[model samples]
Target chain A: MSKKVVVIYSGGMDSFTVLHKAMQQGLTPYALTFDYGQRHIKEIEVAREVCEELGVHHKVIDISAINQLIGGSSLTDSSIDVAQGHYQQESMKSTVVPNRNMILLSLAIGYAVSLGAEQVYYGAHSGDHEIYPDCRPIFVEKMNDVAAVANYEKVEIFSPYLNNNKSGILKDGLAMGLDYSKTWTCYNGREKACGKCGSCVERLEAFAANGLKDPIAYEDT
Target chain B: MSKKVVVIYSGGMDSFTVLHKAMQQGLTPYALTFDYGQRHIKEIEVAREVCEELGVHHKVIDISAINQLIGGSSLTDSSIDVAQGHYQQESMKSTVVPNRNMILLSLAIGYAVSLGAEQVYYGAHSGDHEIYPDCRPIFVEKMNDVAAVANYEKVEIFSPYLNNNKSGILKDGLAMGLDYSKTWTCYNGREKACGKCGSCVERLEAFAANGLKDPIAYEDT
Candidate 1:
């Protein structure tokens, strides 16, 4: 039997790649997505479709109740506009969702413990380290320390792309022949991806770095 | 204006005490409760009542969505029987919710960050150290480390009862003239508290150690 792992699938390019990478490594991946009242809720639908196509055990947890508590971020709060332009720009700081990664990771660890899985995979790449403090190496290291003793059954946080940039992750996913079109990277939940948002711009840059055109439709393309 | 703190109020003796303690310290307390599909869900109602009486800002976050992901514990799983006897006993391990504190603390930290509050208080005590891994000192220490860096706002995990037993916590509440009847600590969520269950037994013991009777009615009283 293959080792089971919980993959924090956000329907974003990074997590879509992480899901495939987990399968490629012979680990049975259980996809866990969170609906945290993000502006780009379309990603949840995208995640559901991809999980269905892959026949993966997937759960889209509706944590929208926390929206009242963890607001002020452009991602979860409608009042704040999503940042545009470069992903590493100072304006991108508005996109930080408080302690989002910790909350998601904690829930994932609980799920992994319930399933008796000893590992959880999340796509916290190097590019996220610039604006999101929770995506930094130190945050993951401290979170790992918490996860190790948080339960009777110790769960390890496995972020294979922690040191890798988005381009590197995309390159690996392309090597696996993964479908990037299935993922959503726009901060706006429109019919077509908004190419102006920080997330979409970064994703486009990643695809460009890989010397390939993104398969997804973009409003500004 | 007084400083603000997010209190993980569970409507148990420990948290109820912590809520008052926060107020006593001249800190504005925002009570945060989680509805995690525990068998003793009456505690949530009790928590609501206490928060109302205190005129404190309260939020009952419905995280029951994760119940599907974390369902092995007797607290949340109906298939498992509530463990009886002392909380320190081996059988009481059945009451351990997988990574429960980490999940609660993470959400509390998020809420704190959102409110610009730098502190989060939870009711983990020395009595819980035996059966629950998440209640241990190391667990709080590591979780604190994660909380410190999880967000740009830097929320702190403040477990005042980490080294204090239930009796000590009870003593503090007694000194504050807190009404114990408002709190619920039963594992079973029947009409009355099941006095034989680990939580009830421990709570009763705490009251006894404080040389006072618990105001709440119990089934076996």
Candidate 2:
């Protein structure tokens, strides 16, 4: 029997790659997605479709009840417009969801414990460290400490891409012959990806850095 | 304006006392309760009543969606019986919800960050150190480290009763003239508390240590 890992699959390029990487490592991956009332809820649908195609056990937890409690972010609050231009722009700070990674990881640890899985994987790459504090290596390390003793069964938080850039992650996924179209990166929830948003721009840059055109459709391009 | 604090109010004796402690400290208290599909869901209702009577801002977050992901504990799984006898007994280990405090504290920290509150409080005490790993001081300290960096707004995890036993907590509540009947601690979800259960037995012991009769009615009493 293969070891089981709980992957935090957000239907984004990073997590989509993370999920596939878990499978490639011979670990049975259980995808855990959270619907935290984000503006880009389209990612949840994308995640569900990919999970179905891969025959993976997936759970899209609806934590929208917490919307009222964790609002004020462009990702969750309708009033705040999603930031455009480079992902490292100061305006991108508005995209930060308060304590989001910690909350998601905590719940994932609980699920892993319930399933007797020893590891929980999330995609927190180096690029996010500039804008999101929770994505920094230190934050993940501290959370790892809590996860170690949080339950009777110790669960390790495995962020394999913590030091990798988005381009590096994309390069690895391409090497695995993984299709990126199944993932969504645009912060704006629209029929076509808004290439202007910080997320979409960063994703496009990553694909360009890999000397390849992104398979997903873009409204601005 | 007084500073604000988010209290993880479970409608148990410990949290009920913690909620009042926040008010007594002259800080505005926002009560946060989670409906995690526990067998003793009656406690949620009791929490609501106490918050309503106190005119405190309260939210009952329904996270029952994760019930399937976090089953196997007697608290959340119907297949398991509520453990009887002293809470320190080995059988009481079944009552441990996997990583329960980390999940709860994470959400509380998110809510606190959203409200611009600097502090998040819970009712973890020394009595639970024997059976629950998440209730220990080390777990709370590590969670606090994550909470501080999880968001741009620094939030603190404050477990004021971490070193105190249940009797000490009860003494504090009694000194504040708190009404004990408003909080529910029975493991069984019956109309009357099953006095033989670990939680009830512990509560009874706390009252006895205080040399006072408990105000709540029990099945075996």
Candidate 3:
């Protein structure tokens, strides 16, 4: 029997790629998304689309009340502006939601545990480390230990590309036949993705590194 | 200056008693409630009402989406009824919620860390030990070690009545003007609490021990 896995699917390039990889590894994927009152509900919509397209078991858990308690990220609040700059800058005030990955990954583990899934996959790559500390491998390792003791089991939080950059993720996704065009990667919830946002910038850069323009169109360069 | 304490307000009798004790200690209470989508929405409402009456800061963190992921308790699920009669029965199927106390306390600690709070007050009495392993002093001790490393600074989880029973909690509440009338302690949500339920049973017994009948109404004696 195939092992069960739940991917933290955002319908973004990284998560879509991660889901594809899980399928290739012969693990049954349970796609889990969070509606944490983020500014971009588009990613959630895209996530639903991708999950429907993949025909995998999908669950969207609502933890929006978490935002009521923990705030400060651009993704969560209107006060913060989405920065249209490079990814690795400290000036990117648009970055950093408090314990976002921690909270989401915790929920994902909960879902996985509920479904009796042994593994939880995330798309936390080197690209994310420039913005989110929780994306770093050390955090993942530490949280895995936390989950193990919290659940009193051997549940593993597997971030297969924590050491890899976005280019690596794109290549992996391409190999897994992930349709990056179907994915949404913008932090700005505009008519079309504002391609200059850090996420958009990274996505465009990754596709360019693969010697191809990003298939998705954006309102801004 | 009054000390700031994080009170794990579950809207239950023990938690209400804990809140009253925090006030008596000259600490301003910041109430933390977990909205874990239990069949017990009444208690969450009671939590809100109590906190409002106390004029304290209240934060309801929704962990309902991750139910049974950490704890396996009858309180969280409708499939199991709240146990009645003996609390020490080995076959008390109504007494589990995976890791109820651990997760709630961890979230409280997380909130306390953000608030720069030194102490977290919870209601873990000897009366609850017949059912909840997480309510035991030994687990709280071990978890204190875990929290010390899991967080940047240590936050103490204080169970004021570690050796006391439910009647002790009621006695404290009565002394502290807890406004027991507004607080709801019944597990069964109906016109009136089902007195036979574990929670109502306990509450009545506690009030009875104090030579006072419970102010709250029950469908039957």
Give per-model TM-scores: 0.96, 0.97, 0.80
- Writing each residue's lDDT as its tens digit, candidate 3 over B1-221 gives 68788998888888888888888878989998888877758888888887887798888877776663444566777776667755666546455655456556756766776677888898889987756666767766655655554444567889998889989877877877666877777767787888876667677888889998777787845
Clashing pairs in 1: none
Docking class of 2: high
Candidate 3 error regions (>4 Å): A151-154, A208-211, B1-3, B40-42, B59-80, B87-91, B94-120, B124-183, B190-193, B200-220
For candidate 1, the docking band is high
Instruction: Give chain B TM-scores in order.
Output: 0.97, 0.97, 0.92
The candidate, 2 or 3, that scores higher on TM-score is: 2
Give candidate 1's error at residue A78 in angstroms.
2.3
Model 1: CA > 4 A from native: none
Q: By descending DockQ, how would the candidates be arranged?
A: 1, 2, 3
The clash count for each model shown is 0, 0, 8
Q: Model 3: how far is B71 from its true place, Å?
A: 12
Compared with the true structure, what per-residue lDDT tens digits does model 3 show for residues A190-209? Answer: 76888788888888889889
lDDT of 3: 0.76
lDDT scores of the candidates, listed in order: 0.90, 0.91, 0.76
> What TM-score between 0 and 1 does chain B of candidate 2 receive?
0.97
In candidate 2, what are the lDDT values of residues A54-120, reduced to their tens digit? 9999998888877878888898899988878998889999888888998899999999998989999
Interface RMSD of each: 0.8, 0.9, 4.3
